[model samples]
Target: MAFNTCVSVIRSASHKAQMIHNQDVQAVSTDVINADELWSFVKKSKSTVNRKS
Candidate 1:
């Protein structure tokens, strides 16, 4: 009765928390990849400029 209701509520909250955590992890990974790509592009352009000069 009341106990089962409490258990269900707790399970629901836990599931929501897990979902939010997964989303955060995904966002961080995407940011890291973007940063790496930007860094590589900057390096390449710098090298090309140096070669021309």
Candidate 2:
């Protein structure tokens, strides 16, 4: 019975860790995409302003 309880606890902890890791991966990907998009917009705007001047 003790062994079974230990196994159950380990499984639960592992599952929680996996979920947290997945969430972190998603957040990082979203941040990277946002940064890339912002950079592109800034570059385009700078070029446009330079042309006008």
Candidate 3:
């Protein structure tokens, strides 16, 4: 029972992370006009991203 519970929790967390990632992809695609725009956005924001946080 303990193993099953751990598996269930892990699956749930994975699904949630996937959903958030999909949302981020959709948001970026909609906001970005083209490849250049996306690249520029990332380049400009690269310094602001927290690596381990």
Candidate 4:
């Protein structure tokens, strides 16, 4: 039960953080983008990601 609670809290925080990040990203225009860094930040290889592909 404790583990599930912790996961829920972390997930909530992650969503909030992602939302803020998305807004920031949209507000700026950059010529160079690093896909690998973004993927690493979101844990692309792990199951925590909503979309694996």
Identify the leading candidate in terms of TM-score.
4
Q: Write the per-residue lDDT of candidate 1 for residues 1-53, one digit (tens) a residue.
A: 69999999999999999999999987763433447888999999999999999
Q: What is each predicted model's overall lDDT from 0 to 1?
A: 0.89, 0.89, 0.83, 0.85
Q: Could you give me the TM-score of model 4 versus the true structure?
A: 0.56
Q: Estimate, for each residue in 1-53, the C-alpha lDDT of model 2 and write its tens digit.
A: 69999999999999999999999887763433347888999999999999999
**What's the CA error at residue 22 for candidate 4, in Å?**
0.4
lDDT of 1 at 39: 90
- Residue pairs of candidate 3 with colliding backbone atoms: none
Error of 3 at 18 (Å): 0.5
In model 1, state the lDDT of residue 51: 100
| lDDT tens per residue, model 4, 6-50 | 999999999999999999988998898779887886685575555
**What root-mean-square deviation over C-alphas does model 1 reach?**
15.6
Supply the global lDDT for candidate 4. 0.85
Write down the worst ten-residue block by lDDT for model 4: 44-53
For all candidates, the clash counts are 0, 0, 0, 0
TM-score-best of 1 and 2: 2
TM-scores of all predicted structures? 0.48, 0.50, 0.49, 0.56
Predicted structure 3, TM vs. truth: 0.49
Instruction: Show where candidate 2 strays beyond 4 Å.
Output: 30-53
Which residues of candidate 4, in runs, are more than 4 Å off? 34-53
